[model samples]
Target: MTGPRSARSGFSLVELIVILALSTIVMGGLTSVLVRQQRFYRGTADLIETRSQIRQAAGIIPSDLRGVSTAGGDIIAISDTSMLFRATIGQALACAPVPLANRIDIPPLTLANKNTLASFSMTPGLGDTVFVYHDGATEAAGDDVWVPYGITGAPTMSSVSCGDLIGSADLTTPRYSFPLASPLRADVTPGTPLRFVRRTRYTLFTASDGAWYLGYCSPDCAGSTPQPIAGPFLSGAGGTAGVAFTFRKADGAITAIPDSVAEVSIVVRGRTRGIVDMGGYKNTQVGDSLRFSVAIRNRK
Candidate 1:
């Protein structure tokens, strides 16, 4: 006779396997959804960062671009690396909250020589860059750097001196150079500039006749060189490929002189970093690019 039937409370191997398989399928679907959501968030974040960075630049460049002291080349002769940078100075009276009955005259400013040192920071090229072709080639060209000396109190203001040039890498160092002018993308309303503004601008021309390209630099000269300073400021790789500056005629309004780059543009190309296929991990990485442009103000 068989022993009393054992009251078993255990799942068979097949049942266990079935349960595990079903659980795994459900989990897998949940994981896929989660991963997709994460990716979406990441992409959105990246896009936001890109826009923010470019916009920051835009906020500053305009004032300085309109202030450019010189402008040459035909209407559309700029390229990726270089464009005309004009400088204008709003005198304390002109820029002051108080309205002036007479026109206020602002003096011109200058960036000091590279060797001198004191408080301000210095880039590699003394606020200058080698204007090159899109191929990253730099041939003999005009001085890519131009320091303007216009604006309020500048004429009588002390010239940029050894004391003005900071030796440290970071601009905020105790001896940081002045922010003489706002970058060419910011405020259009003319006003009094900060006392510690820069006095130089740089242009990089990657192409000759014309093509899309980026143009960025400190509103006024600061560091010893533009290379080290502007290089980092440029669009980081996997980000925008170029920042284009544009010069356009404002509607029917025409200046006896040609109206040029009242604004600059920021263009970018973003790329995908990476992600897993079915594993829900960072395995299969890919890349793509995104682009953006902004017409930064050149004055005020």
Candidate 2:
């Protein structure tokens, strides 16, 4: 007779242990990769958002602060933590007619119903210290503290009283090299590079017309303030105002405002959501750091 036999279907202890160990190793590797990728995606999202914010914030001044000024002097004050400055406003839309060149019949720059300085603390620049008819030379090395324009390198003319505007000469050569007490044929040095050319000066007659518009200037374009500059870029066509600057420090023992704050440095905070591993835990660090400068377009 055969001896009694017993059967067992379950795995051996060693086999089960090996299988568990293998699964653990695979899981660890996948977790590591997921963590790293999640961080990367979050960082990318934050960066894109920051870049967009920088662009929008930076554009506010350069594009609009062409001629911003105030009667109490050029006004400059920061608006908020993310944004900056909220200076008083003043500017007009006037009809300036040039004599000739491109768009021979563009019409005059129409004045706006009211004067809005359109001044804000969006940009920071040494240019704030500089004025349309400033009395000094430019610093070719450091900043634009007194970047002289005059009829030389930049605009010198005031209003487009006439229909004529300036023309494009060689960038390599500048026509007038100094400020003038007044405008006339004598302001420029005769040659191919006309310091001043005759062109059309268009304006936004009713915010509907698309040539150019007038800006406002207080008690005259002086002090530390900005004059609104609407459209149709022109030479010597600048407005002015006074500038007052302040700073905010994060240090527990906050020190006095730094002089270097010719511009305001801002870290714009924004949010974005996306599918990512470790969703909250892994990407928390990714959504926070972006910095851009909101300089005072007019920093003296």
Candidate 3:
């Protein structure tokens, strides 16, 4: 009655408690939404990267397998987590075809000689692979074949000093010649139909990092470190496994002959890695797998 009663200035205890509780609930919801979005982004990014790796492999693996140089256990050395095979390396032509010998003859066509230091791709090194094919129109009936040769040393080509041939003189071409692992079983003569020889290898190997990769090397894959053609085998529950190369005959039967492999089935498996454990996110994560069969054009 006399003076105004003291006005309430702050919230009551009960009111304060309710306000704090509501704020807590709101923040929790927002946090959950953010976390969910982040997780989704991570999973998507991982999947995309993995797919890119797979596509890169698709472009190379099949073609190399198809071009495998047939030989006795030389085309396909081992077909497990690791695979090894010979492939054509370059486009050096034989000016004159001669009988099977350990040496290859190169003409003075301004070719990029692998036997020269500037662009040496023909000089066979240890573990290098050499192959011969009859480009002749009338090859021996049974002579329709590809033979494999092992590389023994720094092969000598004609009288060239180095293995490079970028800007050499016309006369400097030197009629390149390089030795082979052994003498050829047949004759190779240059003409309307030229016999061809090549050097390269396709191999699948597991790196020190516990990942699988596809590698390619010149001459032979034996002594040289493989240049990865495909990489980072991400598979299994833990996301670390190698790709498998399955060779099949034209009739879908498994065979060992390099030329007999009519189809190659490749399978790649992988899973995304997690930054943090979200109730065992790996188990809940979707695994990735790529499988396809490639027909070998060079294989019968």
Candidate 4:
């Protein structure tokens, strides 16, 4: 029909097929890379979340243990998953004029004789239990024993003056106003400082959801149903041996007596979240553990 048909300006079937094959290869590589990146991001996120949870669990344990009472028989019990002990709610430095009776007179022990009327730490609330400790009498050398006495009452600010104990007013020393649960077994000597603390029984239990939680009660562990302190935890996951405790005496000997325990070593172990059972690829669960020791100051 025509002298010589001009070569077609469009690609031939062979060229089109080749171009399609190359595009398929490039797209396959891109898809593979995208999938790999997605997996990496997911793994990283899981690790970070798990570590955060571990840190939260670890931080709370020490803070609670630090407040343990130093009085004899303060620690009620200790086990793999449970612990009961007394904790201090408030403390003061010194008691100058002594032989305290039903009331405690708190003076300004601060520098420059500053009146710490509102700064007293032992303002007990209702349903609160307090323990008084006399720090003056020396039972023996280096045997600073704190004589504990229990109290149960709401505290009030007292301004009336009685005997040598002076109440802080517009021109007097401040004092803690509360009724003692009972009179001291013996007199609190002069220059002997006093300490007040609240005792609580803390129990860590495994909930129905397979998570660990902290529960607490007042006076004694068997008095009431334990209420959770914060939220669920993953610290108790390792079957029967997940959580453990070891006690030591002040003389550095292992002791079973709860009162003689000066140091407690706690160990917690568990696997991170998002654990999978894929063979080889996810053969084992990523687990972490936290171990630390708490020195019971009062017991020691």
- TM, every model: 0.41, 0.29, 0.60, 0.66
* Model 1 collision count: 75
- In candidate 3, what are the lDDT values of residues 1-300, reduced to their tens digit? 598799879999999999999999999999999988887777677667766777777777665555453333335554644455554444454444346556665554444543322223244356555555554447556646555555566645564332332335544656556566686555554421222234455555666776666666665666667777665655322324447667888788887666576677777665554442343454264456678787766554
Residue-wise C-alpha lDDT for candidate 1, range 168-220, written one tens digit per residue: 33222222222222222222123223211233443532333233223344443
CA deviation > 4 Å runs, candidate 2: 1-11, 69-300
Name the best candidate (by lDDT): 4
How many pairs collide in each candidate, listed in order? 75, 67, 26, 1
Find the 10 residues in a row with the least total lDDT in model 4. 162-171
Better of 3 and 4 by TM-score: 4
Candidate 4 CA-lDDT value: 0.58
lDDT per residue for candidate 4 within 1-300, as digits (tens), equals 669777879899999999999999999999999976776666666655655655665676667677675455657777666677655566653333335466554444342335332233445554444444444457664545466544556655544343333333332444455566566545454334555655566556665666665556765666466666533445553553445577888887987778788888776555545653332346345666678888886554
* Overall local distance difference test of candidate 1: 0.35
Between candidates 2 and 4, which one is better according to TM-score?
4
Estimate every model's Cα lDDT from 0 to 1. Answer: 0.35, 0.31, 0.57, 0.58
Candidate 1 residue-wise lDDT at 186: 20
Error of 1 at 33 (Å): 1.5
**Each candidate's root-mean-square deviation in Å?**
15.5, 16.9, 7.0, 5.6
Highest TM-score against the true fold, candidate: 4
